[model samples]
Target: MTTDQSSPISPYLTFDKKEWAKLRAETPMTLDARDLERLSGVIERVSEQEVIEVYLPLSRLLNFYVGASQALHAATSRFLGQSENKTPFIIGIAGSVAVGKSTTARVLQALLSRWTNSPRVDLVPTDGFLLPNAVLEERGIMNRKGFPESFDTRALLHFLAEVKAGRPQVKAPVYSHFHYDVLPDKTITVDRPDILIVEGLNLLQPAKLPSNGEAIPFVSDFFDFSIYIDADPELIGQWYVERFMRLRKTAFRDPAAYFYRYSKLSDDEAQATARHIWETINLANLKANILPTRQRARLILEKVQDHTVQTVHLRKI
Candidate 1:
């Protein structure tokens, strides 16, 4: 397959899907349809064909990177005459909502765990780090939900730090879409895995400097590798609405669902609400925060319509 020369050359080396697929030769296919179905999110379509063509190669590449990291760590330890704790290789997956980042992270977790070098892989989504609904309401940023400000940035940083420091058990807060809030008393304990995948909307964002010029740490700083899923804003907006409608028919039908009211709405009314939410909140967040961080990712997956990745951009070393 020919490269898209119209795309500007940069620090990134771009490859279309056909060329990228060629790199997957000899990588074992360990996942089946049942695994893909379980990994996929509501309304998200991750086909086996797509997995073979895209994720298999990506997983193999990650395996090589992880192996190299372990080797380097060992060499450093030998030179220092002291054993360093084995830190997890953290991978950050960032993108707009409805861009299928969660699905990508899940698929990677499954694929990477199957590797002999990295047998234990954990996926922690940043949604769990989002401030509770009450906090957003008190801060008067309820309308700005999903924006970077809606998250507990300090808490997220601390959590990642502990994980990278090789903490035995790092507890992460849990968020429930059904309840539309962070579960106060509950937490997900992440043991020191061989690999950790952190997925969220703004994982690739830069740090916000203080007025006094104090340096702040970014979530991306903890990432050994990062991926940004990209698509046209218009397509993402449409996908958001489509996913909303699907949820209205499925999850919203539950009486305890946060969006239960949407399930009762007429089809047209539901569509309107979805469009309004996308345009006012999600789209705004994408433009202001998420999209700007695409260039910061180590890898970029540019998706076309039907939620398929057409090009893969790998940052040059």
Candidate 2:
């Protein structure tokens, strides 16, 4: 394990890839290539090696955390001399766009579900909480679609609150990437599961205070554990552009796609358009909002080129 020499007394314990992989020796590998293909996002690569080295250890660690949390809740219930419902263990995953946050969430969902204790793990993405396209246009922030302001923050908070309160069935709005909008009158029901994984770009951000100085609950306040996926800004930009180009040949080619225009453009033209979007939108969002929350995560997975995690930092208790 390689410790951060600069911050010798920091709260997080850092480990290189090799050191982290050793922690998963007893964990079984249950996923195959076909399973990975279903879980992977567009243009994102997740090899079987990554599943064994990175996700297997992560799943084992999560199992420990979940068991500890359940024990704590049970002890509290006994102390109060009352029966209490078993609340779901929530995990938040945050990262910049194109940093493979979705892929990580999906992979974790699969791995965690295979565990005997947390077989009913569920995944919820914050994209569904985003305001519809018409609402964004009405607010005159269509160009800033992925910004914090573009999300229905209160709705997301309420959803998390209900989940934590042990609601029998909670519904979340459904988001369609092809239409690039939140579907009206559509929702995905989440029954009380053993675990829930919430993935997004800004879940770790602090709450916004009102003029009265009252503090509102942030989405991350409901998270028992959180992870931040880290990578170089320049490399992320490159990956974003590459994914955009790939989509031009795939999803963007669909006639109903929101970004269908890019599919008809020449390769050079498409590349230019991707660069513009990254520079004007995604990159700006990353610098101002996402990167600032890196230290807030309980764990950080730092990736090198070719999208492989080279280091893992786990916050010490």
Candidate 3:
């Protein structure tokens, strides 16, 4: 079911682009054209105006949140008579594929890092936690690549747990888009940071309660704040197809690329294949896992056909 952005009883305070832009107040725009171009996805478009209006306000809000959290930690440490250890403020960005979650995460990372309160902000994509292609194939779930069951959940949970515990250094497996798989030898080492942004398709998904009442930790358990990117599925599907077509002339042309075979296909054949994949795989994942978790986000950014955010829904505290 679609959310009622206009409902009086809604948990969120909805704001249109203009109303939301007013919230920016005095937050300065720190990103440039080169920064946006470098951080954007293959086919995603981000404008400086979007940053000034939408993201600056967001960075300002997060700066307040981080400051509050830090103060709270210091007070609690003093109360307990213990040395204070820095706990990273974890932010999660969840969305459907082709809905610009990566761009949002990267943009936020840049903005948050620029803030005096959160100069050290790290962004981690959950693609790295996905099961290796070999393991997925062995389990006969290769087609369900982005599904919750397709991830190394235990490993991801352990990493998050350690990070939240104020570990000095944590390592995450690295995945390669060109190879379309996790690299066995490569890992991204994350040092202690003031803020950590975790982005993924299923970050907000809740785990089923065990019949025996055993404790089960979900990925969302570590998130101090979460954002959901929302758009009509039809628009997302169109964007996915457009991105696929564009990849055919770029990334797919590299002989070392996993999708190189797709480069040889005609434009008509490529579009058909992209749509089929969307209908059978990506759309299914969105419906079954991603969309249902939208309300769990502390904030939701609703996008229009052109990929510009049209509405902002901030959950009432």
**Candidate 1 — worst ten consecutive residues by lDDT sum?**
1-10
lDDT of 3: 0.92
Ranking 1 against 3 by TM-score, winner: 3
Question: What would the per-residue lDDT of candidate 1 be over residues 58-122, giving only the tens digit for each residue?
Answer: 99899999999888888998999987888899999999999999899999999999999999999
lDDT of 3 by residue, 243-262 (tens): 99998899999999999999
Report the C-alpha lDDT of model 2 over 169-259, residue by residue, as the tens digit: 8999989988989989889888999999999999999976788977788888999999999999999999999999988999999999999
Q: Each candidate: what lDDT?
A: 0.92, 0.92, 0.92
List candidate 2 stretches off by more than 4 Å: 6-9, 209-215
Clashing pairs in 3: none
Q: TM-scores across all candidates?
A: 0.96, 0.97, 0.97
Q: Report the Cα lDDT for candidate 1.
A: 0.92
Sorted on TM-score, highest at the top, how do the candidates line up? 3, 2, 1
- The true-versus-predicted C-alpha distance at residue 66 of model 1, in Å, is 0.7
